[model samples]
Target: MKKIWEFIATGFYSGKLPKMPGTWGSIVAAIFLYFFWPENIVYQLLIVAVTFVSSVVSSQSLSEQLDDKDPDSVVIDEIIGMEIAMLGIKATLPVVVAALVIFRIIDIMKPPPIKLFEKLPGGFGITVDDMFAGLYSNILLRLLIWRHYV
Candidate 1:
């Protein structure tokens, strides 16, 4: 039970990486999700939902473990955010690449409301901020698709 809890909290050991584990975990999760779903809207939505819930719970546990506002190891937030960014998109290589780049940029920049969201309390703060970043990336991707693909 304890081990299971740890696995769940750490995103199956992705959070334990020595450096930038969260980023690595997110990238890995994105890749896994891309292959696993491959343009299936239902699967994509399921992934987004699962990631969102798991991230919130895991991030909260990680915060308690680290005794900090938002530890880098708490990267389930990034995983969830990236998954949301990829939602509703064809899992093509180009689309995936674009989403990754755009999401990374927006997440790192922490613009406006995204930055503001980070100020919220506890895990909610940690997860919501990244969720907003994901939302921003999703909107931008939609706009791009509409402008060119639609």
Candidate 2:
């Protein structure tokens, strides 16, 4: 059970990869969604919801077990965030690439309220910040898509 949580929290060990583990996690997530995402928006949202809860649970479990406030390797947050960024958006390569870039930028910069989410305790702290980044990316990507830029 703990092993399972560890796997989830680590984003299937994409988190352990050398250099930019979050990017690795995001790549894994983007690929997964590109291939396996549901046709319906509601179902896509359901998948994100389930993964969101799983992220909180698994990330908190791993954080407690490892005695880390926010481990670099706990990148399930990135997976969830990446999924959120692409939610209800078409999964074309250009769109995916644009969403990925935007998501990574917001996540790294942690602008405005996105940075504040890190103050929350435990896994909530670890995850919500990226969720906001993804949200920001989603909004920006939507605009870009609407303008036919992506």
Candidate 3:
């Protein structure tokens, strides 16, 4: 059913929060990552990879259904991006919160290659831009951790 697809594509309705739904989606994802992430980094990475692949597919479908190139109600991309940000990183309160903030900022700003990636067709357009934002946030968070900044 379309409702079922919408539910999954919306990241369990966090994307329907009416305002800053993307931020809400990222927060939920960070919480999920903190509480239930696999102890093994390999498995965590695998989950991120799987989430990314599946998000692309689901986002494309949802986009088509909504007749939009990138629907706000599709936040699987945010979840995937949050996972990318959390990858291989200890999910401490400070670290997780910082990653979430950084991800939100970068995702919102859409600087450089982040904007470029958003130009891709279909779900790749919807999902990859956030992925790059997550990658950027991850690198910054890693550096901050290395420097005891967060």
Candidate 4:
């Protein structure tokens, strides 16, 4: 049913927040990462992969149902993006905080190819730009860890 798709796409209604729903959804994602992130890198990758697939399906369905390209009320993309950003990283307090900040900034800024990804059709358009932002956040986080900057 559409409710199911809406549930998934809205990150279980976190996206229904009156303001900055994406940020609220990302916050929910950060909480999920803090409590549930896998210890094994392989499993972490699997989680991201699954989240990506689910987000794509749900987002596309929700968009069509709502007749919008990228509905503000659909933020499974943010959840999946934060998941990707936190992938393979230790879920320490500092790391979680930094990941949230970085992912949000990159997502909001939408630099270069991140914005371009929005041009894709359906949920691919809805979800991938956030994934790219997460990728950028992941790379930056890894670099900071490598450099002992964080």
Cα lDDT computed for each candidate against the true fold: 0.76, 0.90, 0.88, 0.91
Residue 48 miss distance in model 3 (angstroms):
0.9
Encode model 2's per-residue lDDT on 1-150: one tens digit a residue.
999999999989999999998989998888887788776899889988888899999999999999999988999999889888998987888888898889989899999988889999998889899999999999999999999998
Tell me the spans in candidate 1 whose CA falls farther than 4 Å from its real position: 1-6, 38-40, 147-150
Stretches > 4 Å off in candidate 4: none
Number of the top candidate by lDDT?
4
lDDT of 3 at 33: 83
Off by over 4 Å in 2: none
Q: List the residue pairs that clash in candidate 4.
A: none
Candidate 2 TM-score, C-alpha based: 0.96
lDDT by residue (1-150, candidate 1, tens digit) is 445544765667787888867667677766866677557788678777777777677677767777888877667787777888878777666676677778888988999979998888877788898888889988998887778742
Model 3 misplacement above 4 A: none
RMSD of each: 2.4, 0.9, 1.1, 1.0
Question: Using TM-score as the measure, what is the rank order of every candidate, best first?
Answer: 2, 4, 3, 1
> What's the C-alpha lDDT at position 123 in model 2?
86
Candidate 4 per-residue C-alpha lDDT over 29-122 given as tens digits, one digit per residue, 9 for 90 to 100: 9999999898899999888888889899999999998899999999999998998888889988788888999999999999897899999999
Between candidates 2 and 3, the TM-score winner:
2
- In Å, residue 80's CA in model 2 sits off its true spot by 1.0
Return model 2's CA RMSD, one decimal.
0.9
